[model samples]
Target: MMFRLESVDARQYRHKSKRVGWTMAALLLVFGLAFSQLLVQSFGSSFWLNALGVLLGLLATSLIFAWWRRRPDMAEVRYVTRLKQHLARVSAHLSTLRQASRQGDVRALDLLAFYHQGMAQLETLEGRTMDDDAERLAERLELRKQRQLHGLPEEVAGFDPAELDAFRRSEPRT
Candidate 1:
């Protein structure tokens, strides 16, 4: 069975995840401290039990934070996941989407803008900002500068909801 997920805000989710992870780690430390103190008070200086508490707390903190870091909702995964979601909604994959965009299809243009943005983000994640990728840059320039979409901007940095709105309004309804 398939389940639909509400759209995720990758930046917000990541920020919140970091906060929660830190909070959890802090809580573990506090619990360990309290546990150690209690053991010392109840057992007339229990070194081994205190050490065990510290060790367990550290293990839990590491394991939990590692799991949180690996969540699929991270910004890195979101770039690709969101693109796939958009394509799936329109029953198109990367190759077909690219072909449609090349033909100047409206929906394709919208999706292509997202694809380009995702590619750029992926590049940033890979730590290759200074590297000039000739082919990718050329394609973006060709579309944004050369294509005259009657009422749109000459340089579209990313997908614009208003562009679609204007286009839809300009065309007469059947």
Candidate 2:
């Protein structure tokens, strides 16, 4: 699988790579020493056997290290996966809001608010602009709002505090 290091810091990448490299080297060294000792005992200090063991050990270590170095660190993988999932959720929510708005439903206004909140969350998470979808939704919401207001009398165009109080009083208290 393809791996990306773009989300990870350079220093952290180097530190983790070094730690893995050292751990692998230590394990190889221990294995090489034990194997060489066994070879010597079996063959009575044969020069060729000892040399072959060292050569194979070095080759294996190099190959493993190269493979490990090419792979992305675990932390970076998790971070990128999380970011993708979050963006997917944001896109889905925006699409739902757009559909609701197209139907001219009054409840679209509340869903639009939720869409804006999701965009704000995306912006904060990525430290970048997430306003494209939100801006489109805002324009559609504004048009709907104006159309709704045009159909209403001036006296009923604004919020009614008495209505809010009545609704709140009707709700059962926890």
lDDT of 1 by residue, 1-174 (tens): 222223445566556646766788796888678767777788767779898777777777777766865775554444445544543443434565556567776665654555565455544444447347887787677556434663445433444445444544544454
* TM-score for each candidate, following the candidate numbering: 0.38, 0.33
**What TM-score would candidate 1 get against the native?**
0.38
Model 1: ten consecutive residues of lowest lDDT: 1-10
Task: Evaluate all candidate structures by whole-model CA lDDT and list the values in order.
Answer: 0.57, 0.52
The local distance difference test score of model 2 is 0.52
For all candidates, the clash counts are 0, 0
Q: For model 2, what is the error of residue 161's alpha carbon versus the real structure, in angstroms, after optimal superposition?
A: 66
lDDT minimum window of 10 residues, candidate 2:
152-161
lDDT per residue for candidate 2 within 101-146, as digits (tens), equals 5565444434343334434443544456645677666664674574
**Model 2: residues with Cα > 4 Å off, grouped in runs:** 1-7, 63-174
Highest TM-score: give the candidate number: 1
